[model samples]
Target: MALAALLAAPAAHAISGVLDTVVIMQDVTDSYKWPREQLEWNRVVAQLQEQVHTTERLVQRADRMIELMGTAENAADFSAPPSVMTPVNQAVRLETTKHAIESSRNLFRLGSKTRSTYNPANEVKATFEVAGATETRDENRYAHFAMQEAMYARYRTAATHEEEVQGAETALQEETLRRLKQVKTEAQIAVLTASLAASKQRQDLAHQKTVQAKADLDAFRAQLTTEEARKQEADREWSETVVKRMRDKALTAYRRQFRAVGSESN
Candidate 1:
């Protein structure tokens, strides 16, 4: 199996429909029911988090999208966007996804370590210590060894479960993608329209927050710069003088004066 395929192997708390990730990079306007749309949206978000490794940009992008639509609800309710908004905001959707993926890749460079740690027992090395040595352990060590064996058995069980999930996901991938891309009925379009309207309402509420966040970020950056400069000035505030030195010499200099390092033996 590919290294990535192995690392992101199923975990106990993993979300369902997550492996339905083969998106058709198209200008999608399918009239799927709001609930199904919601499911697909969630799957995309979950997959992005898993594949890319972080959700900072996803959150930011979601915030931005909500702001654009002029409603608070869109932030949490992605499946049902406003029907009045025609053609769908493909740029926003694709850009948000691209940014989300990129941010995760950068933010979680060490994600593999965390992934391995999830199955801690399975991560055990073939040659780990027993009584401070790898080979020729005493009889007393076997109990400890046996305890580890039990732990490893649990790991094996977890691995088996993961493999089953992977197999199921593999079978479902194509079908899920096709479902997402399929055309919708008139009734489905009506539902989608309502979903879109709700989404737009949420998008409307998001704009002011986005503006406020940008302002806050700038202010924080400026404050940080000013504070850093003040810190540097404070570091140089003390004078390096003979009178000052006499009153309070540094510990290293004091140690050097008292100890003859080259000639000393403990």
Candidate 2:
């Protein structure tokens, strides 16, 4: 009877070991496959990232296109229409970029750790601290590259718009001078002078309009620059927040795994 009981004990231990392996395997699989709620959050985050990247690239390209249009001598020609198109295009692009950013922010808020009632701030701080101790320089390099590209593009566009306005004014002046050369008699000169005065008045009005437009453009560009800087800072903060949350979740899972292993050993 003692020999039979001892033999049965080994069989019972083997059965328990098999059951434990199955339970652990199921837990690991479930852990790896995120819950439906977390999966939705991840999807939102991915979408926001893609939209932000796309908007950044679009703004950058628009800036370059505006610059390239500005550099040509005949940019103010009626056929080109760049004077009106450039600013309008930039305004549209900027508005689009702004919308994209706002949308991203909404999605980020929706998917944030705070939404889960998780204490993300401490985790975020720790993540950033770790990143700072390790790969901060690399992250900064990429960030600067994006920033420089956007700045150069914006500057080139603004410069181009200013040049276009100047060229248009210069052309109008030359036209006025050429008309004055054709005057002969006092009557003709009087008519020409009156027409010239009117033309000058019109040119002055146009110049004023140009100056106002340029001012508005400059203001818009400055706003964009300020917004971009704010966005960069926000992105770094968000990254830190995400890292902290992930680290906390990972540690929790690690502890659970340790406990499971210890139980299996017993």
Candidate 3:
């Protein structure tokens, strides 16, 4: 009985030790699991935070795009004064800018959403291993990507269009300025021509008046010459008559004196 008790005591101690080792191992495992769970939770939180940051950036970009659109819209209204070409060119530029912004917004939205749908491990890995790797993915996802790519292409095209429109607008403004200068020069020339014409007309009127005055002066001079000639003829006639009468009276006196002398002598 003593030997059996000794052996039984050793067996009980061994079982207790084994039970304690199992409990310790379970405690260690629980502790490790707790840390791993916490780490995983932290990792998930970090990922969410990164996603939030990305979303915030996207939102900011969208806001900037909105501001750009508003600016383009506002600039669209100020193109009326100079020329028809200017307004048309400005309108085209603004519209192209607006379309480019919209395309960028669409591309950003598509890229942001594509992260959830595209799985590289499932589709890309499968395609690499398989020989006949026909895409069995959802058509909508491919369509989405294609649409985003199209939007990006459209954005580039719209940017090019905007540049072209801006160039056209600059050329139009220059042309308008040139045309305005030409019109001003033409107007000045017309005014000078009118002034010269008026001066010529005034000179012609003065010449005509001078000619009429000279004619009147010549007629008065001719009338005075005719009157002087008639006066001279009347004076000559009166002088001849007076001289004849005087000579006849002298002859009669001499004859009377001679007759008286003869009678006295007889």
Colliding pairs, model 2: 123-244
- Please, what are the lDDT tens digits per residue for candidate 2 over residues 148-223? 3333334444455445545654565566567557543344444545654554454454445445544654566687
Question: What TM-score against the true fold does each predicted structure earn?
Answer: 0.20, 0.25, 0.26
Cα lDDT listed for each candidate: 0.44, 0.51, 0.48
Residue-level lDDT tens digits of model 1 in 1-266: 69888666653333334486653443323433566889899999989878665567688887775554544332222252233232123212222222323343233222223223457555533345768877532433233333333333333433443344334333344333444354233334344455545544434433333344345445544655687699787766654455576667676676776686644753
Number of the top-ranking candidate, with lDDT as the measure: 2
| Candidate 1 local lDDT, residue 74 | 25
* Predicted candidate 3 versus true structure: per-residue lDDT over 1-266, tens digit per residue: 99988865523222324544632223324544687799899999999999999999999998776554443323322232344344333333432323433454344433344323456553321123247665443444344334344344444444444444445545544544544454323334344344444434433443443344344444444655676688788888788777877777777777887788888999
**Would you list the clashing residue pairs of candidate 3?**
none
Clashes per candidate (backbone, < 3 Å) = 21, 1, 0
CA RMSD of each candidate after superposition: 40.9, 50.1, 46.4
Question: Which 10 residues in a row give candidate 1 its minimum summed lDDT?
Answer: 86-95
Could you tell me how far off, in angstroms, the CA of residue 235 lies in candidate 2 after the best superposition?
A: 3.7
Better of 1 and 3 by lDDT: 3
